[model samples]
Target: MDLSTVTATLASKSYDKVADICDNLMLQVATDGIGYHDDWPYAIHLLSHFYVNDINSARFLWKSIPSSIKENKPEVTAVWRIGQKLWLRDYAGVHEAIRGFDWSQELQGFVAAFSELYTKEMFQLLLSAYSTISIADAALFLGMNEDDATSYVQQQGWTVDSASRMLTVKKQPVVTEQKLDPSKLQRLTEYVFHLEH
Candidate 1:
């Protein structure tokens, strides 16, 4: 494995490329040597999966890790704690986990990227789930303070009632129409007709 490539990829913050790089290197090693990837950079590799929101792959990767490695490295476990929060859809816990862990320099960029994307996703969920929510709740949901949350909501075209301190969320228009592929539908129709005949 080329440590320099991994380092440069992490610095570049191309997380998907990082995943591809690490996974390909591990596959090459496994094919040539023992079938186990015991010496891989399990922490960053697991993080790359999370960065891409590939939760199932991250879970499998975590399980593949040797017990001794997990026991000795608290940072890896700390990274997995965030993954657990994400898996459980624990939004509040996700914020707490990010703040709660003492991340090494290597992991900080990916964790930050994950937090930003997660918050954006939660904002979209808020548009769907709530027409009105208190500033405090919005702050919690967006991982910002009340003041910053107020500004953020206002920037998104959400209006705040000063007396009530509640925000009226401006939701994106929902696409309700399900477009059927005409060719596929016709093929299925013909198949069913042939079967019946």
Candidate 2:
């Protein structure tokens, strides 16, 4: 597989295609060894997974990479650590891990791709920790503007008190279903059994 073509696809935001190519390339590497090339392809494969928010896949790829290669490329190791912290929702740790480091173009792209999703996760974490918080504070925590924060709260059906500048998060309603009629249950069971057989 041509790594440059894969990189171009990624740069064009063709994430699904990038994923497919990365999978095929990794399979080739596994079955046919690295050939005459180095392990940079593995790094690209990990980045593709990360770009699509497939943290588990990225972690699996990271583990599959040889420890010697990871040690030689500090950037790959750093990316792995950042990915781990991101998966664990350790926002502070993630920030600390990447601080003062000059990221490569590929690493920068991965971070940029995940930025919005990471902000959303951070917002969820903040909301879980605080039932009621000022909109400004929430916006700061979420790395969003005040208007965006208000819109986000509204989207979740949470109440925002403009006068108090506070957001009130009502618990989501639990949906309970009425018991099925005996005849309906019997019909469903028969249908399922017929499909299984």
Quick one: best lDDT, which candidate? 1
- TM-scores, each model vs. reference: 0.80, 0.60
For model 1, residues 109-195, the per-residue Cα lDDT tens digits are: 888887888889889889889999999999998888899989998999999999999999998777799889999999999999999
Tens digits of per-residue lDDT, candidate 2, 52-95, equal: 66888888878778778887887777777778877987665665
Regions of candidate 2 where Cα sits further than 4 Å from its true position? 95-100, 121-131, 134-197
How accurate locally is residue 191 in candidate 1, as Cα lDDT from 0 to 100? Answer: 100
Candidate 2 all-Cα RMSD? 6.4
Extract clashing residue pairs from model 2.
Answer: none
